[model samples]
Target: MLTPRARPARAAGGAPRGPPPAAAALAPQPAGADSPAAAADGSPARADSPATAADGSTLVRTGAGWIRGESTEEGRQFLGIPYARQPVGDLRWKEPRPPKPWDGVRQAGAFGNRCVQSASWDPGYEKPSHTEDCLSLNVYVPDGHTAQRPVMVWLHGGGLTAGAGEDIVPDTFARRTGTVVVTVNYRLGAMGFLATKGADGLDGEASDGVSGNYGLLDQQAALRWVRANIGRFGGDADRVTIAGESAGGRSVCTLIASPTARGLYRAGIVESGAYGDCAGRERERATGDGAAFVKKAGCPDPRTALACLRAKPAKDILAAQAGFDWGPVVGGAFLPVQPKEAYENAGAARVPVLNGANSDEGSLFAFSRYDGQGKPLTAGQYPQALTDAYGPELGGRVLTAYPLTEHASPTHAYGATVGDRSFACPALRLNTALADRGPVYAYEFADRTSPPFASLRELDTDFDFGATHVNEVQYLFKHFGLATPLNAEQRALSRQMLQYWGSFIRDGVPRADGGPTAPDQRTRPGQVLSLRTASAGGTAISTTVGDEHRCDLWDAVPAG
Candidate 1:
C-alpha cells in the first residue's frame, strides 16, 4: 500500500563534477595473497612509506591491489575503496560490475566523491556532487585484531537521494564493539532508480525490459565484495550484519525480501526506518514514474529512451528528477514482491532482526514542515493539518484521539500522530510479522534529551527535536562526519547501545551484560526495550510500547 512520492533531500554536501580517471591496467593478483613478496610484486616500497608510520598510517593489500589507509588509536581505516566499476556512460543505469584491477598502490587516505546529489544539512556533503565514480566502501578494523571478527556493513540514509559512507566514522565503534565495520556508497537519485517499461535498450541490466533499482543492486554488489574479500581484513564474511537508518533501514528490510541477497548477510538492524508499512513500490507505479522521468529528460520514446537518457549529462538527469520518488521496484527478479508480503508469507530471509523507532520519531518531520519553515502551527490550524496529512475521515478520528489539550502545542500533537502512523506502528507490525519466522527484538529509543547533529544545531530553531528521526544514529556512531560529544549519562546510554548492537552483530541474539534483558518479540508480544540514560531509569524492558505509541488505533487506519 505504500505510494511513491517526491522524496525530500534531508542530508547535505557540495556537488562535484566529472567522471573519475580510468584505473591503470594491472595484472590481477591471486585473491587474498598476503605475502611480503606480494607487496613487492606491485610497486617498490617508498623510502618514507612503512607498514606502520609515525602518523599511524598503514598499508593493507586487498585482492585487486595494494592500498594504504590511516590508523587511529582505536583502529585502522581504509577509506574510499572502490567496490564496483564506475556506473557511467553506457553503464549509467546498468547493474554494477566488479571494479577493474588497478596498478601500484591506491591511496585510500581520503573518501571518494559522494554520489551526485543536491546539498542539505549533512556536514561534509553540504555541496552537490556530480561524480558517478561513487560506488565505494570504507573499512574499519580494530587494532591488534587476532581472529576473524564479526562484520557490520552500514548503509547511509538520505531518503535514498543523499548521504555517503563518510557520514559516520566508525573507528571508535569498531574498536568498542570488537567488530569490523564497512560503510558503503551506492547510486542515488535518478541515476540510481530510474525505471522505464518496454525500454528494451535497458534490458541488459535486468530481464524482461525491467529497469531501476540500480542503487539496490549496487548495495548487493558491495555485499558480494565483502563476502569475497572481508576474510583478508580479518572479518568473518559469513557473520556479516546489514544495518542502516531511515532510507538505509528500509533497504535492510528490502534486502531481507530479495532472493538475490540471501546468504549475503546473517542479520539486520532497522533504526526508525519502517515507513510506508515496510512495502516496496509496485511495478506499474515504478514504470509510470520512470516513463514520466524519461519524458522530462527529453527521452520520451521508449525504444530510444535508454540511450538518450544515458547520453544526457548526469546533472541534467538530476534536474529532471527533482520532484520524483526513487526506491526499489517490485515485480522483478531483484524484488519479486512487496516487502510486507514477503515477511507475512515467510518468503523473506530467515535471519534474526532487531527493529525499532524513536519515542518522538515524527517531531523532526513536523518541525521541518511547520516551525523549520518559520510557520509554526497554531491551535486553530491543527485540524486542517491533520486533514491534509491524513484524509478528512481518518483525520477526524486522529484529531479526536490526540486533542491539542493533551499536547504542548499543535505541532506536538501532529508529530505524535505522524510518528505513530508512519514509524512506530509500522515497526511494531514488522516485528510481529518477522517474529513467527525468526527471532525478533524490538526497542524504542526514549532518550528525548538526545543532542541534535551539527546540521540540526545549525538550523537554530526553537523546535524541540526530542528523540526524533536520525537522532539515535549519534548514540551508535559519529553522525554526518562530525562527532556529537555526549554527557556522562548520554555516554552511558551510548555504551549500552553499542553493547546491544555489537552483541546482535556478533551473535544472532542481542545481549548486554548488565543492561535490561532484550526479550524476543515472539515471546514478549507487545513488549520492547526502552533505551534511556541511568537518570531516566536507564535502559529497561517495557510492556507499554504499543499502547504508548497508539498502535492499536493506527492498526485500523487505512494504509494509503
Candidate 2:
C-alpha cells in the first residue's frame, strides 16, 4: 500500500550534461488578464500567457524545435511533446535516442498514447490508450513564474506496469506552488523492462552496452532534455527536482543510483516506492523472461529474436512480458550494484532528499474475499497468512507482536502487520541510511479520513481505505484527478504541504512559515513530520513514527 523514501539527519547537485548555454530572460507581460506573448516563434510565453492566448494555442521552443501548446486558465500547457525518438521499429528494446529534429512546429495539443502496459486504475485518472511509441512528456509553466523558478519533473506510478504523465494534470502544482512542472511517460511493463542476452547486438557476456532497464533510461532522457531546453520554458535548469510516488518513487530511487542520472537534478522526493534492499538477480530473471518471450513469440533463434518481438502486436508482447519480475535490475551497467548499496556507499547523487510513507500502507493488497473495515480477522487467519508469507518462525513472532484482538479484524491485523514490516519500517530504514549520508527530511502522512482520487474510490470494497498507501497524494497535488475534493481542514493541510514542498524545491529544505519545522536526523534523530489535518487534531512536527511502526521489531527480522 505504501511507497518509500530515503532519510538522513537534517543537512542539504551533481554533474552537468550537454553543452554550456548563454543566459536567458523572460519578456515582461502587459500586466493584465488578457495579454500578448513577447515572441511569436522562440520567445518565452507571456508570464501571463506568454505563448498562448485566451482559449487558443500557445507555442514554446524546446532545444529540438518549436511546438504549439494547449491553453488552460493557470498557464499554457504543451502536451504529448516527444522528448526522445519513438521507441518503435528498430528502436524497440534499445536505449532511447534523441527525437529526430523536427522540420517545423509540432502540434502538442493532446497527450500521446500511454506506453503499453496493463489496464490503468479505472476511474482514477484518464490515461491515454496504449502504444509502443509512447515516449513523450508534458510541460506546464504557470502564468506568473519567472525564469528562475524551480522545475519539478514528475513520473507517474503503477508499480512499473501502468500509468502515464498525462494521468495527473499539472495545473494544481503550477498554480499552487508557482513552479514549472514537467510530467513524462516512459516505456512500461515488458516493453520497458525486458532484459535479454544477445539482443540489440549485445550479449550477456558483453560489457555494458544498452541496459535492460530502458524505462529508467527513458526517464534519464527526459531529464537530459529538460537540462538542455527547459530554460526556454522559463525553468531554471540548475534547480530541477525529480519527484514521484509508488513505482514512480522506485524510478526516483534508481535515478539517484544511476551514473547517467548524475547532475540531472538538485533534489529527490520519494513518497512510498523506495523500500527493499536490492539484489543482483533482477537482471537474470528478467533476461530469462525475455528469452521465454522470444521463444513464445516464435523467435527462439537469437539472430531474429529482437526483430520478431518488435513485429509482434504490443498486446501480444506484453502478454508474454507479464509473468516476470518487471522492476529495475541490479548488476547491470546502469546500476552496477543494488540501489541501497549505491546510497550507502555515497555513490548516489547527493541531493537533498525528502522521503516518507503513509501510516496504513499494506491494506491495498487485502484479500478480495475479506473486508477491510479495520475488523479483526479470525485469530487463525492472521497467523496463517503470516506463516504462509514467512515461515512459521517469523510468522509466530509477527502474530505475537500483533495479536488479532488488537485490531478490528483478522484482515486488518494481517494487513497492519505486513504493512509495518514490509512498507513502513523498510522506508524508515532507507531514511536512516540517507540521514547517515546527508541532510534528510522524513514525514508520515496520517490523514486517514481523507478521500482518495475519485477514480481510486472505484476500489472501495467492504474494507476501509484509511490513510493507506496513496492517500497522501491528495494532500499534495490533484494527482491527475485521482483524489477527491478536500474539506476545509484538509485544504489547509494541502496548503501547508505545498508550502513545504515549494520551500524544498526553492531552498532544498522542507519548512513552513509558522508551522512545525521538519528536522534533520543528525541534529534531531528519529523526528519526522506527522502530516495530519487540524480535523485530526493538528499536524505534528515531531511524531514518533519509528516507534509506532515497530521499526525495532522489523529491524530484527531477517532479510529475505
Candidate 3:
C-alpha cells in the first residue's frame, strides 16, 4: 500500500487517528526468484550451496534451516536466513523474539521482506516486496577461503524510514577481499522507532516497557546471530566490522554508544551520516506521545495496546505511521543521553573507526526539497536558509567558510558548504575525537561527479552532485542492482575499496598487502585519501582534504 513520508505533519494530542484501510490491501508474496520451501527433513531449505567448498561441494550450517546456494564466477551466496524471528502478532513493538526452532531442514533461498516503507523515497528504482516479517540477512563468502575469514556486516541507509538488506549485494567485495560479507534488515519507520507510554506509567520509557530502540535492538540481534552462526559459513565471529552509510552510518554511531551493543563487533565504518546526536529527549517524548495517540485510536484498554497493534492489519499499522513521530530517544536505560554526550564522556564502545563523506551531501536533500522543479537557490539565499534552520551566529560562520561567490552557481557552493558542516564535517570530528583512543582511517569521495539518474539529472544542471550521499555504496559493495551500473574505472575503484575495507576488518588498521604505496597510500597523519580517477589509473590522491577543511573545529562544538 502507498504511504506518505513516515514523519507526521501534526503533533500528538491534536486529534483522533486510526489505521488507513489501504494497509489491509497489502498481502504477503514470495520475494524475488527465491521462495521458502521444506527440505528433506520437512524444515525450511537452506540457501547455502553444497558446491561452495574448494572441492565445489560442501554444506554449511546456520541458525535457521540450511540448503545449498548458487556458486558462480562472482562468489557463493546464501540468502534469506532469518537472523531474528518475525516481529508479527503479539511480538509487534516489543523486543525482538528469537526465531522459532524448526523440526526439520528449511529452505532459505530467497531474501526476507524489507521493512515496510514509503515506495516514493526508494532511490534504486526498486520497491519493497515484504513487510514486518522482514528480519532476514544475506551472506557472501569467497570460494577459495579454507579457514575462518574476516567478516564485514553492512547496514543500509534511508533516513531511518527506507532502505533494506536487499538493496546491497556484497558478491564483488566477497570475491575480491576473500572475506565474508553479511547485509542485514531491521525494523524501520513506526515499527522500529515509535515509542509509546509504558504500563508502569513512566512517560519516557521505551515502547516495549524497556528502553525504546527496537530498530537498534534488531541490529544487535543480527550481530548476535552473526557471532553465533557466522563461523559455520567460514567467517571469524571474533573479528567483525560493523559498517553503514547515511542512516546506516548514524546507526553505526548509535551502536558504538549503546551499552547493549558492546562486544558485538570490533570496528566501525561510518559513511556520510554521522551527527553527534540526531535524537534528543524532547524528540523521544514526542515519539512516545505519537504511539499513545495510536493506542487511543484502536483500543480503550492501555494494557492490550500491543495486542491491538498486532491484530490491526499491516496497512492500518503503516497508515497510522503517518500520525506517529519516530526516532531515537535519550535518558532511557539503553541510551542514557544523546550519542554525542556518550562519546564525549567516554561512555561509548572503544573501537577502531573508518569514517568519511561525499562532497555533495546536501544536494540530495536539497534536490528532494526543491522537487527538481525550480531554479536552485542563490548563495545569499543559502546562508539565509541556514540562519532560518540553525541560528544567526552559526549560519554566518557557515556562509563565510563556504562563500557562494567561489562556485559557478549558488546551488553548487551551498550544497558543498552546508553538506560538509551538517553531515561530512561531523563525521570527520567523530574520527578525530576517537583517533587517540584507537586507529581511525578517514577518506573523502572526491569523484568529480557521479552519472546522474536520468530523471534527476535534468532538474539541477549547474551543480554536479559530486559523489552525492549514497553514490559510494555501489563501489563499496560492488553490487549496483539498485543503483546505476558502474563503469570500468568505477569497478577498479570498487576493488580498491573492497581491499581497504576487508583489510580493516582483518586488522584494526586498513592496510593492503604491499603496505602504503606512493600514489594511493593508506590514511596517515595529515593525509586524507582522495578517491579520484586519473588518466594513468584510478588511485588515491594524498591531499589534506580533512585538515584543510578544518574538521578539528568540531572538537570545540559542544555535544548536543
Candidate 4:
C-alpha cells in the first residue's frame, strides 16, 4: 500500500522504554552432537531442555553464538537477535552481512532499535528512530511444541519507512496457531532503497554503479537466516510462510517475484498489499531520483557524493529524503523484473498464496487527508478533490460511480473510490494472476466495526473507520502488546481468523472446524471469503465484491 510519504504532524522521538527483568544472561547447556538434548544444528537445546537458567529463561545456540530469551506464559521468545550485521558507517546501503559470532550468551530480551525512520500514525512506531543497527528479528515458539512446527515469517507494515519487528506481540498467536512466528526489522526509507549510480565504494560493492532495493535484499537475508537456523527453534524451515500487511504484504509479493527468495519459503500470506506495480521503479528513474536526493543532502558533487553521503549524519539524510517516495527499485540482481510481469509470465514462485484486502481500505487514508485534520470533505469540494487525484475524465467517472448521496458523507465517497481503485481491484487482479500459477485463496476483511489502533483512537475526531487499512492486524495479533476491544462476536471471528491462518501456515489450506471455508480463486473465480461477525452479516462466500466495490470501473484505471 502506498501511504502518505509525508512525515507525521506530531513531534518526532519518544521516551525509550526500559528492558524487562528477563534481560539477564543465561548459561549454555553442556551438549554435543551425540546428546539427545542438542538441536539439529548441534546447538544448545530447546525451551524444555535442561538449559533453562535459574531465572527461568531459555538459552539457544545459533551459528553465531549463544543467546538467552525469556520464557513467557504462552511460549518462548527470542528477541533482538541480529540476522545481519549492523548497517552503519561504510556498511550503510550495502548488502546485509552475517552478524559476527559472539563469545558468550547475548541477551535476547528487549527488542533491537527500529530502522532509521520518522514517526508515523502507528503507536508502535510513533517515535523517530535514529539507529542504523536494526537488522534484527524476533522468534516466538509455543512452550509445548518442540517438534519441527511450521514457521510464519512476519514483516511489519510501515510504508517501508517505519515500524519494527516488535510492533505486534505474536506469542499468543504462536501458541494458538501452533506455529513458530518470526517478526523482522530491516532498513527503511532512503537508507534502504536509495539507488544512486555512483555510490559504490572502491571495492565495487555497488559495482553496477546503479544500486537500490537494499531493503528487499535485507528481507531476503532474513529469510535466508530462517532457512539456515529456524530448525534450531523447532521450526520447519521447509514449510515457512512469508506473511505481511500493507508494505510488508507488498514485500511478500516482491519476494515472490525474486529469484533469490525462491527456496527460502514455500508459501505467502498477503493482506492489503496488492497495490502499486510490484515491478518497482526503473533504473533510470531511480538513479535520477537518487541524484536529486544526493543533491538535496548537500552533496551535489557526483565525485564526492558517495563520500559525503557516507559521512553525513543519518538524521540529515532522513530529513533530506522528505517527499521522495521510498520503495524497491528494478533492474537489480535482487528483483530483475516487475512482480506483475513475473506472475503473468509464470516466472514467479509457484507457491500457494492467501491474499486479500479490507472492505473499506481507504477510510483511514481519507481521514488523514481530510477529517483527521478537522477539515472534513465538503460536497462542493469533492469534485475538485477527485480531479486533483485522478484528473477530470477519471474524476467525473468516479463521481458518477460513487455519488456523495450514496455514502454517509463526501469523505466516505472519496474513500470508496480510493479503496476500489487502489486495494480491492489490485488485489483481485493479483488473485487471478496467482491462481493461474498455483492455489490462491482470496478474502475480504469486512468487519466494519474493527477496532482502531492506539494512534487512531488518540485522534480528536469522531469519524468511523470501517475496516480501514491495518484494521485487521489487531484481530490476528495483539497490536502494540495491547488487547483489542473486540466484543463477544468479534472475538469469535478473531478466533476463526486465527484458525484459518493457522491452518494455512500448517498446511496449504485455510479451513476451520465450524467457520466458513475459504475457497481458492481457481475453484471460485470472482468470489472471495467475506469475513465479518455474525451480527455484521456473518462470514460467507461473497460474490458481490467485484460489482459492489466497483472493480469493473477501476479495471480501466491504473492501480496506484
- Provide C-alpha RMSD values for all models, in order: 5.0, 8.5, 8.3, 4.8
| Steric clashes per prediction | 16, 36, 20, 2
User: Poorest 10 consecutive residues of model 4 by lDDT?
Assistant: 6-15
Model 4: per-residue Cα lDDT at residue 153: 98
Superior by lDDT: candidate 1 or candidate 2: 1
Residue range 427-513, candidate 3, lDDT tens digits? 666765566456667777766556543334434355466677677776765332333466777656666676777777887676643
Query: lDDT of model 3 at residue 324?
Result: 55
Better of 3 and 4 by lDDT: 4
Which residues of candidate 4, in runs, are more than 4 Å off? 1-57, 124-126, 198-204, 207-210
Give a tens-digit lDDT track for model 2, residues 289-391: 6678678767787766666777888878866765666777666567777777888898878888888888887666553325534444576566677898878
Per-residue lDDT, model 1, residue 249, is: 91
CA deviation > 4 Å runs, candidate 1: 1-57, 199-210
TM-score of 3: 0.80
Measured by lDDT, the strongest candidate is: 4
Q: Of models 1 and 4, which has the larger lDDT?
A: 4
Residues 1-560, candidate 1, lDDT per residue (tens digit)?
A: 11111112222112121322333223354432233334432554443332432223356666666676665666777778889989988778888989876655666656777897876655544456788878989888887745578999998888888877777778788889989899999999888888777535432453234467899999999999999878767788899999998888989999999999999999999987788866777778888898888888998877777878778887888889888988888876788888888888988999999999999988877887788788999999999998998889988989999999988789988989988889998998989888878999999999988986566776677678788888898898867545677899998899989999999999878878678767898888878999998888988999898888788889997542
Cα-based TM-score, every candidate: 0.90, 0.86, 0.80, 0.91
lDDT of 1 at 85: 89
Q: Rank all candidate structures by their lDDT, best first, as comma-separated numbers.
A: 4, 1, 2, 3
Backbone clash pairs in model 2 (N, Cα, C under 3 Å; residues 3+ apart or in different chains), count: 36
What is the C-alpha local distance difference test score of each model?
0.79, 0.70, 0.63, 0.81
